[model samples]
Target chain A: MKLAEAVAALSLEVEDPQILDREVEGGYCSDLLSDVMAKAAGGSIWVTNQVHANVVAVASLIDAAAVIIAGGMQPEEETVKKAQDVGIPLLSTSLSAFDVVGRLYELGLRGTLRDG
Target chain B: MPDVKDVGALMSVTYDVAARDFVRAGEAASKLKRLLQQLGLDPAVIRRAAIAAYEAEMNIVIHSYGGQIKVDITPESIEMICEDSGPGIPDIEKALQEGYSTATEEIREMGFGAGMGLPNIQRSADQFRIESTVGEGTCLQVTILHEAGE
Candidate 1:
């Protein structure tokens, strides 16, 4: 799925459109940056509630397709700016992490996500 | 000439462990990923290498006094070596248990060093080998097979 399509489907508000063209090949939802860094496949969408800047580092290191901050959470300016600079799309949604994962599953976009 | 097909490409990197520096820890793995990309490795193989490398790197920072990680990349497989000289595990058997963790609260705040680290490393690698001495250090070698189509 294209980044724009993922944003639209998840009802997420993207602060930048330039980074929205990247494709979403998979999805990984986790609050722990280590887990995400170690497990998130490249081009996968990362859904997390943590607003820490380290999240951006993890996304970059793993080459995540984009970042989806759930539960109406907003990241710091540095976080948003870094994402912009790195061409990593940053998104926010009012849905909980579980909710976003469920929706992504419904969209038939699941790929290698750990089962609960 | 090293047979590129049968002999894995040798790559080694040594990081100076600043003992309490968790902030800069995963940097080596990121660089390794970039190198792997430049080599035009398969995405699936790269992902496995990245996971094993990152996990091993994190363990060095969180558990070891200081150490280094070396990676051997091959068209057919990838091998990772992580060696650390910290407070060596007295009980290797128990330490390998899934829920066994010696990580402190500070490490937990950084979201790592979980008792699951070893298990996670094992799970991520297709083959895993670990060696440790009670008062010495620990050495871990992990291998992941690459599917030709991937």
Candidate 2:
């Protein structure tokens, strides 16, 4: 699913200019960095309420396609800019992390067969 | 992929993980992930490598003074050696238990030091080894297999 499409489907208002409509292959929701790093499938869209710069860094490290800041949270300026610099689209929504993740899953965005 | 018997086919990479710097903790793992991608490793192997490297990286940041993770990859498998020179784990058995951690309040606020680092590493690697001294340091060896056709 395209990121724009997902955002629209979720009825989320995209406040950040850095968001682009890249295809989101899958979705993983977690606030624990270790779990995310260990278990997040590649090319998956990440949904979390954590707004720290390290969250951006972890998403990039795990090769997550994009990051959605759930619960209407906006990241710090440095975090947003870093996401832009890394070419990873960042989004925000009022939905809780689980709600967004459930929406993605209900839309048939499930686990992907990650390729090299 | 190159044959393991061919020594020239072996590729090795090392990353230094600093301690107590929560901001820079996951940098080494991120670099390793990028290298794995550039090398065109299998996604499964890449994931395993990421998990191992991440746990090792977290250990350095939360527990030890500092450490280094050295990865040697071949067509057959990837071998990792993580060495730390910080205050070692006094009770390996207790430390191995899930939900057991000695992290400070400051560390917990950052959403880490949950005591899952070692267990995550063990779960991710095909083979695992750990050694530590109470006042000295710690070392871990992890190996993950990439069997034929995997």
Candidate 3:
């Protein structure tokens, strides 16, 4: 699925649409940066509760398809800027992390594993 | 395809990492990823190096005072050296263990300090080494080699 397609279908707030057409291959929900780095497969839609700029950094390093800040959390201005600067798709939702992941799964995005 | 010739000509690159600066933590690692991408390195190898480099960069940002990440790239391999100036790890044995971190509450709240950083880096690199002085600092060397088959 493409990020923009999912965002429009689910009504997710597109915080930054720098890479809306980017491919969304998988999904992973975790707030732990190391865990995300170690296990989240490339091009996954990373669902996290972190609202800091570092979230953008992690997403970029792992080449995530998009970052969904769940639980109604809004990232700081710097985070949105960083995401835009790096051409990463940043999204937001009022749903909890679990709910967000479930909806993404419903949209046919499965979680892929990367061996740590 | 990008100029593989440029990647072959590459020797070493380095970047400064600021301590406790979560905002800019993954800058060096991301740049390294771009360089590898430009070289058209193996996707699997590039991902491994990127993840490892990110974890190493985060360690210096979360634990040490400040540091530098130096990377050397070739068609066959990538070597990264992360050296930091801070209160070094008192026990390498314990620090290498998963789920054993000394990060403050603030860091934990930001979704770090999981004690998985070092372990993750070790897992991603084909060869990993660590050296630290109690009061001086810590240094990590990580190398990821690419296979011909990809």
Candidate 4:
């Protein structure tokens, strides 16, 4: 699904709108940056509670479609700037990580490597 | 004793990593990734190099007092050396085991200290070496070769 569509489906707050048009191939949920770096597939939407500039770096390195900061977390200002600079959408939602993952799964978003 | 002729012109840059500074932990790795991209290295090679650098950088930030990461990029390979003055690991073998972490609750909440740092870095590099002294510090050297035949 398109990132913009997924954002609307989940009621996520758009932190950066420039990236909403990118296509999302899958979803990955992890708080550990290293886990995402090693395992998350490119073009996947990364769902996590991590709110830091490093999250932006991980998203860029893995070529993630976007980042959804679950639990209504607010990232540092620098993180928002980094996301904008990299042109990756940074998003947030009031739902917990588990809930966000569940909703995305219901919306046909599977894990990057899982077979639906 | 390998032939030095295999090595090409080298470019090096160093970055200082401050301990417990979660805010700036991955800056070195991010910059290194950009440098590798600008050099037109293969995407897979750049990803591996960047992941290794980032994991090492996080280790220094979580476990050390402070340290520096030095990166040397060449046509043949990318090499990273991270050295930090901090509480060195007492048992390297145990520390290398996945899921064994000494990170505090604060660090855990920051999404790290799951004991995957060193292991992940090792997996990302072609050659990895780690040295530590109980009271002194720890040093890691990682090398990632560019795409084979490139």
- Highest lDDT: give the candidate number: 3
Best by DockQ: 3
Question: Clashing pairs in model 2?
Answer: none
Q: Which stretches of candidate 2 lie over 4 Å from their true place?
A: A11-19, A102-116, B1-7, B148-150
True contacts kept of each: 0.25, 0.43, 0.89, 0.68
Residues A1-116, model 1: lDDT tens digits: 88788788878988787778888888988776657765667789998887755577678778888889999888878778767765778899999989998988888788555321
| Candidate 2 per-residue lDDT over residues A9-62, each given as its tens digit | 888655455555677779888777776776777788988887777777778877
**Residue-by-residue lDDT tens digits, candidate 1, B29-126:** 66677777888877666766776677777777777788777677665677878888888788878888876778887767655655666776777778
lDDT of 3 at B139: 93
* Every model's TM-score: 0.76, 0.84, 0.92, 0.89
Task: Give one digit per residue, the lDDT tens place, for model 4 in A5-115.
Answer: 888988899976766889999999999877888888789999999998888888987889999999978888988988998888999988999999999999999999421
In candidate 3, the residue pairs with backbone N, CA or C atoms under 3 Å apart (3 or more residues apart, or in different chains) clash, namely none
10 residues in a row with least lDDT, candidate 3 chain A: A15-24
Clashing pairs in 1: none
Q: What is the C-alpha DockQ of each candidate?
A: 0.29, 0.43, 0.69, 0.52
Per-residue C-alpha lDDT of model 2 across residues B63-83, encoded as one tens digit per residue: 888888888888778889999
Runs in model 1 lying further than 4 Å from the true structure: A8-16, A33-41, A76-86, A102-116, B1-11, B15-17, B74-77, B134-136, B145-150
Q: Give the clashing residue pairs of candidate 4, or none.
A: none
Deviation from native of the Cα of residue B7 in model 2, angstroms: 7.3
